[model samples]
Target: MSWLVTGGAGYIGAHVARAFIEQGIDTVVVDDLSTGRKAFVHPEARFVQATILDGERLVEAMRQFDVTGVVHLAGFKYAGVSVERPLLTYQQNVTGTVSLLGAMEGAGVHHMVFSSSAAVYGTPDVDLVTEDTPKHPESPYGESKLIGEWLIADQGRAHGLAHTSLRYFNVVGSGTPDIHDVSPHNLFPLVFDALLGGRTPRINGDDYPTPDGTCVRDYIHVADLADAHVVAARRLEAGDRLEPVYNLGSGDGVSVGEIMSAIADGTGIAFTPEIAPRRAGDPARIVASGELAARDLDWRMRHGLGDMVASAWAARKAAAPAAE
Candidate 1:
């Protein structure tokens, strides 16, 4: 059966697309290239350059590809920018998802896997969040994602769609030399740029209540995250009736200082960082239990923080010359 991947040319989506290709699955990627790169799209998979907002085009693509399942990963995902452009975020994340679901329904594709984020927890009372955690999103980005998850859940019940929502936190690492983070908003790429440019990296906050007084996040390698998607897809294919929410993370927290230390060790670049006030709406710590994913999907993270940083550093160095 063929699978349709939305935003499959983007960062995480590209990696997941690679996983599907390696499995010999017939895959079709639909991306508008708004933020995705055509270079990241594999030659093995059919690529369609179109926006999901175009419901007719999306439905036509699904039918043309004979799509049996969909992995929804397209949307705007900048937390800070989402705050300033709330309506835009809602339109892309919420409205875009609705459009995709409609297309899927029309094509009779009932299985879906969504790329969600930990931002939905919004500084949960507990340090480690689970799939059942009450969502109290702090930013428009988070709110939009939460709404997407709710839409998937409600649609699944109302229309007999089987779906899974994987909530990820701090997705890092590189899958291949050619595919790297070109996004300006993510933390790892920003730090990589500063170090490669011989400039000091800036730490947003240094007074969070953590051990290092900095914000702590669970960093999961992108390859491992991609593997989790494969497993989730297999489970869906196996006809497992389950809830649609699962948290994918390392189940351990690493502070900003700790990440910088790993980057220094990985890149062998010794540069001090400037401490700045915390950005608005950043949570002190966000660690996921990941127990549900491990138990249900039989998934476990293989790479640690050091591996994540080292791989990212190598990819960053390779991209630097062209980035100039």
Candidate 2:
């Protein structure tokens, strides 16, 4: 049996698909290629280009591939833009999840690993966020993710569908040079774009209460994040119980200034970032404790900040030619 990965062609989803392939897990990728790239899909896996909203198609694909589980990652993920497009965010994230779950039921697929977000804990007041942290999502995107988790849990309780949700923070770096983050909103791509275009990177705000006068956020490697998903999926497939939700994060925090410094050093381009005024609702610091995930999912920070920077830079540079 294979696992169906919705949005498997995406930045993080591609990494997840790659991890599954490496672990000798048969994979089936279904993507509409909205923000995802077809080039990122691995050749060993079966690919079906269709939106998750199409329940009939999903059921057919799952049955065709003998899918036993699902790794659901398809969604609209821009928190800032989600404010302007709440309807679209909910339709894609919440509605799409419902459609996927229905299709899974139709195909008798009972396992799922949902792709959740740290945005669910928007500007958390605590020093280190945990699974028990109070959820105060500030945008439609975050709200949609929380609602998705609720739907999954409700489905599990009613239908015996085993599942878990993974709340990811700032995921960076690359497992392969061929696959790098292409999101315009992400820090790595934003900085890489600025440098590649011969412009200085801009920091959103540098007057925050953080030690470095900039916002501090937990940054986890995309590869490590993918591994955790695989572990969770494996456990679910094995009928092993898991926490309903887990934060896939690095307990340590890194400031925006430190990230710029690392980028400069990694790319060998020395320039100070232009400081922009603070955006409304921006937090000074937001990190998480991965202790629970470490105990259950074998979660570990295999790559440090230096490794994150260097690998991301290498991947960005490798993609520069094609981008031009």
Candidate 3:
């Protein structure tokens, strides 16, 4: 009846953990604090500080918690950074997932929900990527996530293990006061910081083929993403016979320029961005078709871009005083 959430102290993972705790589910968290914060861990859940690569430690935690299912969220997620450090990305994301799967099998935990990414789809020729989209990952990070999904699918076919892999895009917004995002790589937080510091946020490549000439992406609220995980878990727990993949996103795309405008309007931070060349390996437009998730999991994003920006700005403002 209990679940093990890897990287449960991280931004999205912490939100998932909080949602489970609020529903009175017994949970266990395993994180090494590499990028996650101890402050994000819920007090009700048993917390274990360890990496997924440590098979012995992961097995021990699963055994101790009597974990019936797992929500796998541990991985390196930065596309540009992954290109610079391919080996490390593979080691942490790919190899770490392998170790975690091995540990799960050893502990007899058969059901899982994997935190995959739209990065796995890369830049598809089509505007909206479906579940059967061609996966031509551009960076090591994307390839690593694709490998993780393949692992889950293969394990499910070979063994009796059941899983749901939710591929998400541009996850934003806040779920709780104690679990706000601290990563410096993502767009929303970076823009928030630039405005807070009285500096113009840099926009890379504002001359793309899109309507506004800037890259567009689907920005789904983190809470809504967490809700999909809950639905996926429940379906598996209920023994629903289904395929293993679902895209979790808003079915709508927002341009980078649009996001900057939203931040300005929401936070009253008026600052133009400095134009820069396109980031290497960035797709011009990457949106999701969550039709499968909507049909099967009854999942829909309740919050729009405005809501996402406003809530993110709220969290940023609350944390700004301490950061000063």
Candidate 4:
């Protein structure tokens, strides 16, 4: 059965799409190219250039591709910027999800894997987040993602839809030199860009309560995360029941200080990171347990921080000329 992959040209989406291809899964991609690059789409997969907001076109693509399942990843993903552009965020995230569900219904495609975010647990009190963590989203971005999950659940109950939302935290690194995280707000790209541009990357704070006195976060390799997606999709195709949500996380986490060290070692760029004041509401640590995911979806940290930084650096450096 062919699967429809929304946002397949985006950073994470591209990796997921490629992983599906490597697994011999037939795939079709739909992306508007708002934040995705056309080059990221695999040559084996069919591409549809359109936004999810365009419901009719989305349905047409779903039907034309003979899609039996879907992986929904298209949306506005910047949490910080959602504050300044709440309307656009909802339009692209909430409304767009609804439109996608409608398209799926129209095409009779029932199974889906939603690309959710950790922002849905904004500033959680627990050191380790779980699937059952109380969602107290602080930003429009988080709210929209939670809303998307709710929409999926409701649709599941009413229309017999099979779906699972995968909540991701601090997705970093590259699976290949051809693909890399390009978001300005992502940690890896921010540091890599600064170093590539001949500037020292700065850390916001170093006085946290953690062991290293810096923020600790779960950073899973993109390839690992993509593999989990393929597993979930296969489970759905096999009619296996799955959880409503799963977190693609690392049980043990790395600190920003540790990551900086990795970067230094990986790139051979030696310099102390400039420490700036912590941005308001920034927490000292936020890691998650991947026990459930590991049990069901074969989740694991296949690559270490050094691998993450080095692969990302290689891709980012390779793309520098085009970026300039």
Q: Write model 3 residue lDDT over 1-324, tens digit each, in one string.
A: 699899999999999998888877799999999998888899998999999999999999989888989999988878878999999999999999999989989999999999998888878988888999999888999999999999999888887888989998888998765656778889998888888888899899998989998998999999888888887887888899756889986777899999988888988877777889998766788888989999987779899888898888787787788755
Tens digit of per-residue lDDT, candidate 2, span 1-324: 999899999999999999999999999999999999999999998999999999999999999999999999999989999999999999999999999999999999999999999999977889999999999999999999999999999999999999999998999999999899999899999999999999989998888888889999999999999999999999999999999999987898899999999999988999999999998888899999999899999999999999999999998899999875
Prediction 2 TM-score vs. true:
0.99
- RMSD over all Cα atoms, model 4: 0.8
TM-score of each: 0.97, 0.99, 0.96, 0.99
Runs of candidate 3 with Cα error greater than 4 angstroms are none
- For all candidates in order, the CA lDDT equals 0.89, 0.94, 0.88, 0.92
Where model 2 places Cα greater than 4 Å from the true spot, the runs are none
Off by over 4 Å in 4: none
lDDT order, best first, reads: 2, 4, 1, 3
For candidate 1, write residues 1-324 as lDDT tens digits: 788889999989999999888888889999999999998998999999999898999999989989999999999989888989999899989999999999999989999999999889888988788888889898999999999998999998899889999999888899888788888988899998887777899999999899999998888899889888887887797898656788886788789999988888898988778999898767788898988889887668888888899888787778889875
Error of 3 at 261 (Å): 1.2
| Deviation in Å, model 3, residue 316 alpha carbon | 1.7
How does candidate 4 score on lDDT? 0.92
State how far residue 227 of model 2 sits from its true place (Å).
Answer: 0.6
Residue 247 in model 4: shift from native, Å?
0.9
